[model samples]
Target: MRFARTRRDPVEVNLTPLIDVVFLLLIFFMVSTTFETRQALELELPETTSGAAAEVSPVTLVVTAAGVYRLGERELTPAELASALAAEAEQAREHGLVVEADGRASHADVVRVLDQAGLQGIERVRIATTESRTGETISPQAETP
Candidate 1:
């Protein structure tokens, strides 16, 4: 009397479900993450209680606390700023000018920009300000000289 041996199938792990779960988690994290691009200049903008969103402008002038002027990413001197503003004014007269000055920047620097805008016949001017923590208004107004 002899006994016959039986063969069994090899055990296997189904990875499709594991792969699906991993992909779902990846998609969830990608959708929930936020990306912010910070400017090179560390500027603390002035806070305002009442402000309205400004229309998009073609020209943007940034003034640093150290009294440095920047047109776009390029730094410029006061004299160069005037000429640059003139050129921008020609193309952006309808869009107007947007000035972003550091909260600690001198009033004179902002005023000078305004004066140049006036000379270039760009009447529409806006100064950028952050909304107060308590309120949500982005108002840009010129201080009375």
Candidate 2:
């Protein structure tokens, strides 16, 4: 009778260990990764021919498509706006006003609001536009960021 020697081979790769390592790596990345969010400026801007007067956002006096002038929620006409601003001025030290008009709103209406707002002793008057977040309009009026 001849005696034969048996050779044993070792398994080179283990799937379970590999899967565990992969999951550990995924968890590490999930915990260690930092998420940075970029914030955009408020207001959706309307397209305009002159981009210079496009960037500015201040205390907005909104003019709707229906020609309703609003200082926030309160609707005011040209004369009413003057009175409202005058009232605001009497209560406060400095008067600042910004006029926001819809793209469809009449240009005359915006100018009229500005004119009336000025009469109320508001030194700072800006036309609100959705151009830049920092507010950079060219109306000789100081832009509020």
Candidate 3:
């Protein structure tokens, strides 16, 4: 009786399982990935334990009681403030700005600067305020017209 030679099994890495695992991991990450929500600069952000926080970043123009108009540190005029704000806006990823006027500053002072900021097509201008004792910054509300 002649016996047929048995065929040898081919040596191979079965890639189907590995491929399936890789696909599963990919899908899991896609479904589980967390999206970025806030876009503000993570600057040496001024923080207070109890006060509110700004939801967005804007060209912060600081106005002291003495009628000083400043962006970061440099001073500006009303017309120049408008142009400065516009120029600064080019660097901003967001268009919101705040007129950080001191509590002792005149309301008209804040309004004038705000008008300048708005003149450059800036719409979302907010006032910055600090708590009396805590010194934590708070979001200033808009006046009711």
Off by over 4 Å in 3: 1-50, 56-58, 91-95, 143-145
What is candidate 3's lDDT per residue for 33-145, written digit by digit as tens?
99888643222334446566666455678988887789987987655766677678754325577667888888778777756655566655666777778887776444211
Model 1 residue runs over 4 Å out of place are 1-52, 132-137, 142-145
Q: For residues 11-117, could you state the per-residue lDDT of candidate 2 as single tens digits?
A: 67769989999999999999999899865324333444565653333456788877778876688876687776666664322535666677689877866776666
- Candidate 1 — number of clashing residue pairs? 1
Over the stretch 106-143, how does candidate 1's per-residue lDDT look in tens digits? 98898788778878888767676765585443545652
How far in Å is the alpha carbon of 72 misplaced in model 3?
1.3
- Clashes by residue pair, model 3: none
Question: lDDT for each of the candidates?
Answer: 0.76, 0.62, 0.69
In order, what is each prediction's RMSD in angstroms? 15.4, 16.3, 14.0
Model 2, runs deviating above 4 Å: 1-58, 90-95, 131-145
Of the two candidates 1 and 2, the one with more favorable TM-score, higher being better, is 1
Task: For residue 80, give model 2's deviation from the true position in Å.
Answer: 2.2
Superposed Cα deviation of residue 5, candidate 3 (Å) = 99
